[model samples]
Structure formats: structure tokens, C-alpha cells
Target: MGLAVGAGAAGLAIGGGAGIAGGVALGRARERRTADAVASGDGIHQPGITTPVQDHLHFAAFDMMARTTRDDVASLLQDWTYAANRMMQGLEVSATGAVGGSPEAPPDDTGEALGLPASNLTITFGFGPSLFDERFGLAAQRPAGLERLPAFLGDDLDPERSDGDLCIQACADDPQVAVHAIRNLSRIAFGRARIRWSQLGFGRTSKTTSDQATPRNLFGFKDGTANILADDAAALDENVWVSASEGPAWLAGGSYLVARRIAMLIETWDRVRLSEQDRIVGRDKARGAPLSGGDEFTAPDFAATDGSGTPRIDARSHVRLAHPDQNGGIRILRRGYNFVDGNTDLGRLNAGLFFLSFQRSPDRYITVQRALATDAMAEYIRHVGSGLWAVPPAPAAGQSIGAGLLGA
Candidate 1:
């Protein structure tokens, strides 16, 4: 079968140009570790909250030639690595603090890597079983197949199956320098080996989810009523980390998952009156707090009856339904970004969100979003972008990833 690409928006998956680009960019996996505790119900769940650094650029490439030799791949990659490292060094000067104070915040080396970070550019790559097949006699097929290799490309894949594969990632504090570096790298490496598909990502902000009480989306209600939590390492490992049983013993070090893109219609959405917008999203427009009551981060009481004895948090209220119980059950881990393009409407805004989330499966997170898409907010938003691909896991210790996969 031919290769397929996809991207995620909130939760839904769209198709076309955005799909192909998102496919190459969105499928990469990495977590921003946090250093503080988040306020949730009774106590708090703080698995060291860290945001996925935005300034870092991410690039994922697939090998088109399923029949190339491993030695050739290694030779080509060696040259690519030298080039990328030098490029990242230069990009760092423009990044937050790399040169001076970041336009945003400079890179914080203190805590773990993903802990609320943003670099000028972050680049990563993944190799399928086909890349390994040329030398090890194995073909990686499904999303799970990447987990068994040893020395996982590290952040996303398992450690047992990462051997004999090409997985490379690099990050810096600059954007313009990063783009030029990658363009140069591609020109040199693209034809050296068989490239299947490739993608690049640029992040403009570090905050993916809004804090409680923060202004919600166009719908007016405090958004993110349903977000997942990560309280400890074990949970993070189980719920967030990829496994190694999917691929060959030598290929167990990787991970894979699909990503999709979505576009929101702010202009059309703005046409509605304030009250209508609030009713649809179920949150206050200015504060993004729960309607009829509750503080930022506080759960809404769904069972409490309204003036006529009807449920205060209506059965259909986005927040109420997302949190059926006072304990808040409708939570999903959200990690999205914002994107803005030039205006085509003469003198108006033309921008939207690049919604992204990581979950065990699409069924849990996406199922809920499907319902919202058909709700009152449907007319104000459209699925204009999409892409899909299995994100290969991070690289392990003592190994310089990308060396083997790129036929370096």
C-alpha cells in the first residue's frame, strides 16, 4: 500500500494539503516535563508540569526506498548530522536567551527537557522497519512495531527495539537559522537514500492548554473541561510512553501514532451575540470560568438543578457533560499551538489554532470532540487541514540517532 498522511485539530482529523504537512510534522512524540503541581479537585496532580518547548523545530522523514543498504544509510547520515549540529548552533543565537532574552522565554536547562520549554528550532526524524530491512531483514508496519528496538530514539519509543535504525533529532533557539539548516540538510540527504515522506514544525507559543478561569475559546465557556492528567512517572510511562512488543527485537526502540489538523472560523463565530457564544461553548467569554458559578480550575456541579429544577449544568452543557461528577471526569491532556497566516479578506484576521493532543487511543479523546463538531459551534469552524503518520520514538544513550536511518 502507498503511504498515508494526517493531522489532528482539537481531536478531529481533516484532509488535503494540511494533512500532508501535518503528517510529516505532527506525528513526532515528546513531552514537556513540569516542575510544579497543577490545581485539580481534592488535592493536585503534578507530574512535574513541563510544556513542550515551542521554539524547537521538529522534522520527521520516512525512507521511500525499502531496499537500501545500512552502510550507505550510515554514510549519508554522518554528513547530515555534522551539518545539522552546526546549523542548530547558529540558530540558538536568535532563540530566547540564546542571543539575549528570548522574544518569549529563554531555554531553561534546569529541570527535564520538555518542562515548559521553547527553543528557536527542534528537529527530529524516524526510520521505519523498511530502513532496517535493507540490513537486518525486518519490515516495520504498524504504529506499535517501533517499540521493540533497543536504545529507543528515547523520548517516545521503547529501549529494547531501537537497534539498527535511523532516528535523529536536534533543537536550537532560533527559527530562521533552523529553516535554512534543514533546507540545506534536505538538499544533501533527500536523494542519497529513498525518502518516503517528510515534515517540519514551527511553534509560536509555549502554552498548549489554558489555565482554569482563563478566557476560553470563541464559544465563551472556559474550554478544556475534559483534559487528562499525569501524576507520576509510572502513569506517564504507561499512559504516555510507547511499548516495545510491536517490532523486531532490534526495532523495539521506537513509537508511532497518528496526528490530524483543524481550522476554526473566528469571523463567522464572532457574528453571534455574546450570549449565544456563551451558551454554545458553555463558559464565560471574558474569564473562561464555568457558567452560573465555580472558580478557575473548579469543577461545575452538573447535578445541581437550575431555577426551574432543571440541571444547572445542563445535560448538554459542554463543561457539565464533560464533568458529569464533581470530581471532573471529562479531562484529556491537551497540547495545542496557534497559527496565523496573511489575511485574504482585505482588512480582517485570518488565523486559527493547530490543536494537538496525546492519548492512549483516538477513541477516548476524539470521540468526545466528534460530538462538539456537530453542535452549535459547527458553523463557526471548519476542518481545513489534516495528516496522519506513526511518530517514531526518541533515541537512546550512547547512540547518535539518524545515523542509520538516513543511510548516513
Candidate 2:
């Protein structure tokens, strides 16, 4: 599909006799509604939140520049809303696109994805707790559930990559599509925001839909075996999406996202025996069956014993502690991806899972993470970065993203 006409053009077309001010307002409203509809899944494009987990991810976090005003931030969001709508539909950022603009000035779009398919690209935006501080006059509107997460045991978080004022999660079947989205968005925010840290990931480790096969992590185990499926509306309402009555009207349909950069001790883990690995994970590496002897989807028999009368699933095994049964039946939607950045200074692979989960509240993650503090697998992984973001709901046909919170 072609890129939507610019608001200025739309205004000029209809403003011939009506005057610029009124026509501009009417044109913007019309263009916004069109953009919102396209993003809301009226066609092939899907909004990021509901979009199926793709093969690649370009996750970025940014801090607002010191001189950017609240109004500037709002304008940026509006621009992003329009640009994202076009990109998701496989079009350029603007009508002039990457190469059609004036020769003297830089192009509006970077053009890396010029001939690529939409590739099921989705761009999701989020707000961090710091954004609601005194800087933007948004403190009063901050959701009670959007608090900063407390440091967890065994967390080796890097200050530079931990938190940010804003976040954008771009996912696509093709890596270039995902990268292009972030690249153009960053360019758009030139004077307003600077990327704090970013991570590129591949090999999704979770299944958001039943049609997809369960994927594996670097540890060679089927991950997210008991994940919350997108088809389960009730489960999502109960665990993933935040409701209006929950508090903070602006965040009624929003969700909280927690991201962790976990670096695996691959060399150490690789040398472990197969049986030992199964015991540590509480599941067979190949079959992904519970150690108690059932299929991948079979309910784990945490109480079962072995031939020697020992607990089949170790008391401190990764699964036992992370299981919902042990954590008040709390479940978060996992959409993690495997990452291999490069080799560490010591010649070890600097690679692991980029853990991403969405839940109704931060407490959901906090509770489960704390329970995993004593997990046997903790020794094989170290958390080097973390972030918490409040992901607002998709825009309606006439609304901009976070319109309720920003009051734009």
C-alpha cells in the first residue's frame, strides 16, 4: 500500500477557501483516523502488541534530551504514530519517502527497507517510570503499577543499559524490517531523544500462538512450554492486560513489560552431563518432558519420585520454582529471543536469552523472579541489563498512541 498523504497536503487540498487553521485541524484529524485504523489491524498490518511474535527483534530504549519539552515529546509521539502506521503497511515514512524529497535536504526516511515486504513488522512503544517524573509534568498521571523494579538477587545489572525514559520494541520476520523501524524512529527523535541502549535478538524462544512450534533457548531446552497463549482471552485479561478498574484510567488497557538481558555461562553449561542438565531444568532436554515422565504439555508431577525414591524434579530445579503452581498461579506472557552478540573478553560467547514478558503489574514478575532466586539454573546465567515499561494500549480509529495518558 502507498504511504498515506501528508497532513499538510491534505489540509492544503481542502483549505482552498476555508482558511489554513481550520483546514489543518480537520486534515490532521482525518489523517490520524486513517493512520489509527491501519495500525488497529483493519488490513494486513497488525499492531505490535497483538502481532504474533516474529523471528527477529530490535529492542531499543531511549532517554529524552535535556532540552526537549513535554510538548516536543507529544509532537514526536504524533509523528511516530503516523510514521509507524505507514511502515507497518510496507510503505515509507512519508509521501516523499526516502529518495523523493528535495535534493538539498536529507530524506525523511532512511530507506533501508525500501523494497522489503511488510514482513509482519510491528512497532510497540512504551513509557518508563522516569518519563513521569517532574520533567514532563506527568507524575500525577503515572500508574500506581508503573513503579521501578527493585534489584533482585543475583542481578548484575549494568547502569547504562538498565532504565530509560522511553522504549520501542520492533519485531519482524525479517531482520532488516525490524532494524529499519528503529533506525527511522531514532532519526525522527534526533533532538528529542537519544538511544540509551539497544539489543538485537533472533530465534524467538517463546510461542505466542498455538500454531507456532515451541522454540528453544541457548540451553537446548524447549522454552515457554506453558506460556500464556494469545488465543486464551480470559487468561490474558486476568494476567496480561490492565483493566480500567485496576487504577490509572489512562492505563486501563495497558500492560507492563519487563526486559532482562541474561548472559548464559555457555562454556560451563556445555560441559555438564545430559542427565545433570535434565535434573537442573526439571525436563528432558530432547523431549522437553517433565523429569517425572510425561510429555511436554503434560502437567509436571512435582511430587513424583524416581526409582531410588528421590524427588524426580529437583527441589531447586528451574521449572519447579518458575511454575505457576508454586507462584500463586501467576503467569506472564513470555516473548523472549535468543541473542549472540559476540565473544566476551575471555573468548566465551556473549550470548543468552533476551527475556521479555508482559503482565498486568510489575508484582507478577517480581514475585516469580524472587522465587527463582534459589533456582539451580541461576548459576548458569547472569542478568546484565533490565528495564520496566508501561505499554499503553493500541490507538483507536481516531486516537494517537497513549492519547489517554498524554491527553493529546
Candidate 3:
């Protein structure tokens, strides 16, 4: 479970202390000038989820066209795998790229990322429940834990943005690099599949590596303070990754991904009192310390109470319900992002967290989400769009993505 060593534009060494700031600045400069850099063969096709999370994200879900056959879908995944392998190394989708193609034909690559580095670009693919339907003849191959997620209490889901037959998550340190990955993949799909909905996210809402500083959500509170880190190999294997004995063989090394688009009621939250805000989240806004705690990582003293005899961490507080203690020790790897898509019809800022989590089974999320159904924070946030996807493991050399599931 040691970290894999790789050589590519994304493989810049991140130093610590004062060097951290310098390292980031230098990394950005290198990214800008790495367009022509040749990538080493190592770590080119590693699974993105296991790799450190990137700074920006472009996540999209697509549905297959009605006339598209199962074989067509399989071929699309194979083509996507080939293209993704090159893109991750700062190369074009094909040998004859954007400007090298014939004048009468469209270029193989979309030129948006022409001069950009890989920027740690990682494109992960997943299959939705709908993909295993009758159209694909894949129902019997579906994993036992890959069923559709149940509706929660406060959900106000938008149908168009909810479910999909397939999903692709492209993340990178550079925003344009992430966008370009998705754009070309969608282009490659062409008539076989079309985008159902997509989300663009800037600053990360959670940190996956120990070296990274905790990022803040749109709610202005530090998010994922107790999140599972990539270095926690034991926890990752037990909670995040699906084992061969856990379910269907096709999904042995896979994981379930749950995405919830939680929209914050910004105007209303802005007007709320600071103390009330702290009470709602059960943590100090400035320090991220628990109400009955010592520091940011201090375990909450849920049993401690004030002289008034009330629980220090309120029963309905978010931290209390979402805590692993309350959810049978279940934890999911959160890799969320903060998003703002202009103003709403009422002219208020439309902003919130694009909450994403990966787990061995969807039940981990379902259990915790049901617990938070009555959380005080639910009053300030609305669950708008949602999706559950079964993410397959990374492909080996000479294999296509999801080769096991598609029998490729």
C-alpha cells in the first residue's frame, strides 16, 4: 500500500514548510510549460481515486442514445480508455492531434488544452444502475450493492440532473485541463451517448492527502476535517474499496460513488447569527473545533454537557449525526468541491457543495444520509441533484477501462 512513484507532468514533488508555498508556485509555472514534455511510462494508468485529489473538477453523467447497442457502449469505453491514457501523460487523444488532421475532417483532439500540462489530470469512469438494464443485457452482471439509492426525507431532486447510464469524473489542478478532458470524451462518445448533466467546481471542498490543508465549503466552515486520507491504507481497503468476496466478480476492485448537489440557501444563512451558525454546525467557524472539543482533530466530547444539562454537541447538529460514532463506525472517502453557478431566479447566489464520496457499498452513505435527514443544517441546504455510480478499478496494460464488467 505504499504510494506509487510516477514520472509525468503531474508528478511534481510537493515540499513542506516555506517550501510548500514555493513548490505550489513552481508547480503552476511548470504546468504552463509542460505541453511538450514526454511522460515516463510509470503510473500513467493508475486509478484516480487512489491518487491524491486534484484542485479542480469537471464531473459529467451521460445517458446512452436509444438506438445505441450494448456493443456500441462497450466500444466507447474502450476508445475512452485509449484516449485517457494519452491525456494523462500530457499527450493528445491521438497521434494526429487537433491541428494535424485533414482540412475537411474534424481534429482528433479538441484544441482547448493544446498548450497545457497534464496538471495531474485523472479521468475516472463509472457505470450507473441504468446501464445494467435490459438494453445492455447486463442485469445479471450487476453488483449486489449497486442498486439505486433510496429517496431521503429532504430531497428536492431535479430529474434531468439525477440519474445517468454512465459517469466520468475528470479532476486536475488546472481548471481548463479538467474541462478539456471531459469535452473530448463527450465528443468521442458522439451519437452513442449524450450528457445528462454536468457540474464545474473550483476550490476543493475536501483534502485527500495529509500534506494538504483542509479546504472550506461554501458554508464557510472547514469541511472533511475527519475525512479518510489516502495514506490510511487500512481504512481505505476496509471502507472504500470493494473486494472480490464482497460482491459480483466484475466489481471486485471497484467502489460505489455517491454525488449529492447540496444547494445552500446563501441569503438566509448570511442573515443568521454567528453563534447560531456555530451551534448549527456544532463547531467554531474560525477554529473548526467541536463544541466540546480541544482542537480541529479533537474527538468531540458528545457525553459532556453544560450546567444547563443540554448536550454540548446538539442532538440535531451536523457534526453529531454525521460523526462515525453515530453511524456504526461507517466512513466514506469524501472528495467534494464548492460550486457557484451564478444567481438563482430570485437573484440570490446559487452556491453550495458538490458532495462526493466513495465507499465499499452505497449503504455507508445511505446510513449516514438517513441519520442526517433531521440535522439542523438540512434547514439551510437542499439536495437538488443526486447520482450513484459503480466505479470500476483501474485498467492494466493492454486492457480497457471497465474491461472486466464489459467482458472486454
How good is model 1 by TM-score? Answer: 0.55
Off by over 4 Å in 2: 1-36, 39-46
Q: How does model 1 fare in lDDT? A: 0.37
Task: Give the candidate order by descending lDDT.
Answer: 2, 3, 1
Better candidate number, 2 or 3, judged by lDDT: 2
Best model number under lDDT? 2
Compared with the true structure, what per-residue lDDT tens digits does model 3 show for residues 1-408? 111111254433221100000000011111111122122232222345656778889999999998888888877777776666567766677766788767777777888988888787777888999999999889998887787789999999999888899999888888998899899989888878999999998889887788888888877899999989877879988899889898887677678999999999999999999989989999989999999969998999899899999888899999999999999999999988889999999999999989899999999999999999889999999999999999876544455667777875
State the lDDT of candidate 2 residue by residue for 67-115, as single tens digits.
7888877867776777776676677877777888777777778889887
Please give the lDDT score for candidate 3. 0.78
Off by over 4 Å in 3: 1-46
lDDT by residue (tens digit), candidate 1, 34-132: 111111121111111222233333333434344555554654544443333223223211112122433454331111221221232334444543343
